[model samples]
Target: MKKILVIEDEEFVRENILELLDSEGLEVFGAENGRIGVDLAQQQQPDLILCDVMMPELDGYGVLTTLRQDSILATIPFIFLTAKAAKVDFRQGMELGADDYLTKPFTRAELLGAIASRLKKQEAVQEHYNTEIQQAKDRLSYLAHHDSLTELPNRLSLQELFKQVQPQDDNYQEVLAVLFVGLDRFSKINDNLGSDFGDSLLKAVAIRLKACVDDQDIVARINADQFTVILAKRNHKKDAADVAQSILTSISKIFVVAAQEVFITASIGLAFYRRDSIELQQLLSYAKKAMLQAKQQGGNQYQFYTATFHIISVDYLNLETSLRHALEREELVVYYQPQVDLKTGKISGAEALLRWHHPQRGIIKPDKFIPIAEETGLIIPIGEWVLQAACKQTKIWQDAGFHCLRVAVNLSGRQFSQIDLSQKILQILRETGFHPQHIDLELTESMLVSNTEVAIRRLKTLKSLGMQIAVDDFGTGYSSLSYLQEFPFDILKIDRCFVRNITANPHNAAITEAIIQIAKTLELKLIAEGVETEAELNFVCRHNCDLMQGYLFSEPVPPQEFEKLLFSGKNLQFSPKQDHEAKVR
Candidate 1:
């Protein structure tokens, strides 16, 4: 039942209004003045309030204003009771927020009609308010679990979904795979175009990714340029690979963004939930690592997380931790391997090699730690250390009368891509008091394949500084003769893989011979690596190779040992006894 309050200075009028409302089936209360009426309304929380215009303590307008200030009572219906029927008096009450008004000659029918109409209007407004409140709550809930820009489920939402579909109390086991897709070189596009264009491109990519998945699978935007698809009940690695390849092919197509045609590719990594127990984060991490490996191998491909990858990931984490402190602890040392003059049979130069002496693991080979350093970006600082140490050592040897020996330092892809690479190298030379001509920077062929123009520019700048540039591990990368012509490379070092079994394998011998001819045709000096036997050395010599470096000459030795060898003033002559001892060491 609805409750009503009637406030009037005249006791007769108050009683009449209360009785009329009570007879109409409303629970009615009466007050002699506006102040008492407000108190009664607050305490009883009546559905409607009928107040008088003129009263002691508080008038009808004052009562309405006071009630409006209280949140709980603000919306209650208010009406005025007045003796005057003047238009001006009615206007005053209405302007003061009156819901309805009753004059001196008002009938019972008029009073009931005003009360019923005001209550109906209040009910409508309350319903609208409740609906709006509910809608706002729903919007907030969605925003919490989804990406605001893409409107796709975010990492938190993905985690919650995983929890729902995870293996439960039943004996049946379920298999799932998480495919982490990363757009290769998306940042370049983002930078070339404006952020608005980049945002639109991401939206388009999201649409394509969603369309590629099944209804049962979940696709989420896990990062800025990365998306993840959770393939529940599909445990097979091949199924995940097929999906990844489809995604790669779809994204590799042309996309029109902001009226400009753009082409992009993606690298994907898949981690499966077979019978093994793994947390969501660990699985995601594994997929991420595999994706990065795909990117490192030149993107536009897919990789699956294998047992070997997991072991490597753990080792990578541990090695990254140790490498970060290697410089500070002085555990990194430079060893020099002689680059011999195969023609003159004299020591021509040395290559600076980095070796790590772990306190717990003894000496760690570069083959094991160098890749980890490169992946973790520890190579930047570590490469800088090698450059400085090599330059300083060369200057030391030059001062000690070994002026003919130049030192070569291998630059990783990350180091070679630095914007200030040439400047950094020049600064190191200046600080070490070494001539630029005596320091050679060896870069891999793969480094030049990604950004040929930028690589050419940087190489030109380094060449202009009087430093020699050599392509290390040649024939192992996807570079053709055209790249050799375009790049400002002074030497080409044949990869050790080809030279290791050149005599035993005719295929290896043919490739070596072809590489030597190509080097000669380009008029670029050739250096044969891993010449461990006399037959390999004689074959390289027969091909007129410019230099040879391997165990046949000398194993890489510490600075002190290298200095002793330099002081001997003797060229390395191949000896079976010395080669055996070097291999053992």
Candidate 2:
């Protein structure tokens, strides 16, 4: 029911107004003064407010001012009741956001008519607001399950959809294959070309990719440049490969962008569904590794993941099983890499990279198993483990009177896609009794190239928690300077590819210097990665680089080794000469 409020100071006039409104069957609330009327307006949130201009303690103007202060009530209809007939009086009410003004001694019929009209308009405004709210909610829900750029089902939706394709019995175990297709250097398209045009091209490509599949087949956008295809009826490796080739052909056609025709190639990797242990994440990992193999083989091709693949071996399978049990078994460890200040050569921060030690196979590299964990939806648990481990270690260091340093953790692309990643980070800090300033999230360049809006939002949310965000491997992907400005990134790590050649060629040296200058101008901290030699170190120092990390100091070690290094208070020294003929180590 719509409620109406009547505001009039005069007792006789107030009673009369209420009586007239009551006779019309309106749900009426009343106040004798403007101040009380404003309070009533807020409490009742009426459809319309009939207010008298001349009243003690906050008049009609004051009531309107109060209403306008609240965004929720700013658009409520307001009708003024006043005896003052001056143009100035009318102008003052309207300028104060009043909806209507009626002269005193007006007939009840006239008052009723004006009230009805304003009430009808208010109803329409509310209806429109409701409709927009519903539409926005629907879009958000859809975006959660679908890629915003291509409108294709996202990885989450794919996982849910794949569960339905599972085999019910071993006798009739349904066999299928998933092909993971990734665009080679897709980030370059978005960075070199404008984002607007890049988005349009992706939409067009999605349309073509979707068109190539049948109703029974499932196609989803899983990564920035990656798409996944579920071949429900294909059980054999050759059948899956044929389908993969067909998709490559469909996507190979020239894409028209801004009237400029461009041809791009795709790399595809295939993993048989049932053959890959019947786990959605495990299958995705195999497919991605195979896709990487295709990319490594010069792209524009497909590779079917098989037992011959090094990552799908018995050792790898055991490692995956061990990783799933690591958290429960309490077998995860964190190793810290020091961030050295170029000017003072002192440690400023440490990046906490995760490591796992298997009882039988010894220490396992993150590159080998982290993708499996992420694909298997084990990242959330693993990420939480990293956060808690890092925070607890930091707190222990603080208690030991070690230098106060920020510990950074690499955030996978899947981690950033979660709506609660930032909140979870903050919650971990609070629960662990750690300071927000002691942690940061390191994300790759591809994370930003996808949905920048979502990436920016997550960045801002993390920044608000007093945690920092860094772009890791800065130069390897599509590095956009404009994104550097728009998004809140506190650090930029120059890719090892660029840093490797800094000491040899004059052109690479100049490019490295330019990048340093750009980072300096943007007031972003710069870190040179893969610094293995003194010459590279000196070159980075000469350019006023903020930090350096590579074999020159030490390789990524175990937690005990890292702790020993930190406690030794030792400064690493190296020979300052390099062979001109020597290439990067």
Candidate 3:
């Protein structure tokens, strides 16, 4: 029921107004003065307010002004009750934001008509605003769940759809398979034809993919040039494979885009459900790995996830378990690679790379185990150990008078996600007695893209604590020049891929040169990684690269061996032939 508040100094007039409103089916409330009326309006949230123009302590104009300042109360219909019918008085009340003015001795019709008109107008305005709000919300929801380029459901929508179709009971049975499809050499097409052409091609691909699927199945775009098909009610593995082959055939057909006949082939990876219970993300990963395997074999092919993949999955689990014990077993070690200043060929710093010495496996590279550690969330503790060990080593170097060299430690994405990451590093610094300036934290571009605002804030905190930040694997990820401008970074390490092929591939060389120019323009220290050859070293040096780290100097070694290099002094020069021979060995 609607509510109305009546405020008047005269007791008879206030009671009469309340009685009239009550008779009209409104829940009526009364206050003797403007202050009490404001309180009543707030508490009851009345649909309309009838107040006297003159009252003790506060007047009708004063009440109107005060209510206008409040967002909630400002919208309430207010009609002032005044003794004078003068034009000046009506003008004053309306100027104060009163909805309408009713003179004293006014008939009941005038009061009722004013209230009715104001309430109707308020209802219309509110309805319009609500409609606009809902439309905006719907648009946002659609954008969130769909790919903007192809107008296909995105990963988020895929997850939601999977949840909707997923069985409630654990023992429920259904034949379903997820097929991960990726266009081979799509980047080449994009690079050659341009992004607009690429977008059109992707849209065309989406339509073809959708056409290949049944009405009961779902097709979604998960990544750039990557799409996923959910084949529900497939009877067996063969059925899924047949669907995959059909999709491959459909996508491999020629398409005339922009008056050019473009022929493209796709790789398909199929992972079945009900055969093994798996989470949505894990299933997607399996399919993606299978797709990559298919691509490796050659495009226009399909590969079903096999036992070999399952063995790798089991191996990952075992590795995670082994890593948890690695720190306790003293199997985890920090290996240091010296960073040489290209200008002076002097040791300026070193990066602390993590390694694991398995009892049976002998030695395991980080690439094989780091992803497992990250997936299992073991990187948090493992990262802490790395930070502590690296800091202690830096302190040891400082105590031995190697004060000019800093140590860089790579921080995993999980570690950076910690809310207290800065505080934890500070605690480590205090415990190890290492100067904050002597340590640098290396992060990849992927880490910065997920929660950029939070990453920036956390990085700024670390910077304030005197810790250096470096963007590792610089050109390999989705990092843009804007990232460099917005993020607080002290160094950019050119990824090994570019440096390794720089001499043979002009494109790689051009990218390396562009990175060098960017680093120079930003005044950030540039370090070229994987510099294995004398020619690569000379190329970087000629470009005025700030620092260099690769086998050309020394492979990452244990702390004791690195200490020997430190003792040999900062300018531990070696001939190009000698460095190349060492790299070969």
Top TM-score hit = 3
Cα lDDT for residue 499, candidate 2: 80
Ranking by TM-score: 3, 2, 1
TM-score of model 2 relative to the true fold?
Answer: 0.53
How displaced is residue 349 in candidate 1, in Å? 67
Cα lDDT tens digits for candidate 2, 1-585: 668899998989888888888888888878999888888887888888899998887988888988999877898899999999999999999998999989998998899999989988978987886675445334334534666558788876787789877666777544588889998777888898876777787788788877877788898988667889888775456776777888889888899988988777899998886667688889898999999889888999999887677644577677778888988887778888876666545556678888887777778888888988987888888988888888888777767777576688888878889888877887888888889887768898768756888788878888998887888987544454565678899988887867875777564565566567667757899998888787888788767777877777767666677677667764544334832211222
Q: For each candidate, how many residue pairs have backbone atoms clashing (under 3 Å)? A: 0, 0, 0
Q: What lDDT score belongs to each candidate, Candidate 1 first?
A: 0.82, 0.78, 0.83
Clashing pairs in 1: none
RMSD of 1: 30.7
Candidate 2: regions farther than 4 A off: 138-151, 163-174, 183-208, 234-238, 248-267, 294-303, 312-585
Error of 3 at 572 (Å): 51
RMSD of 2: 15.2
Candidate closer to the true structure by lDDT (higher is better), 2 or 3? 3
- Candidate 1 on 305-408: residue-level lDDT in tens? 76676434676778889888999999999999888886557778999999999999999999888888887888999999999999898888899888878999
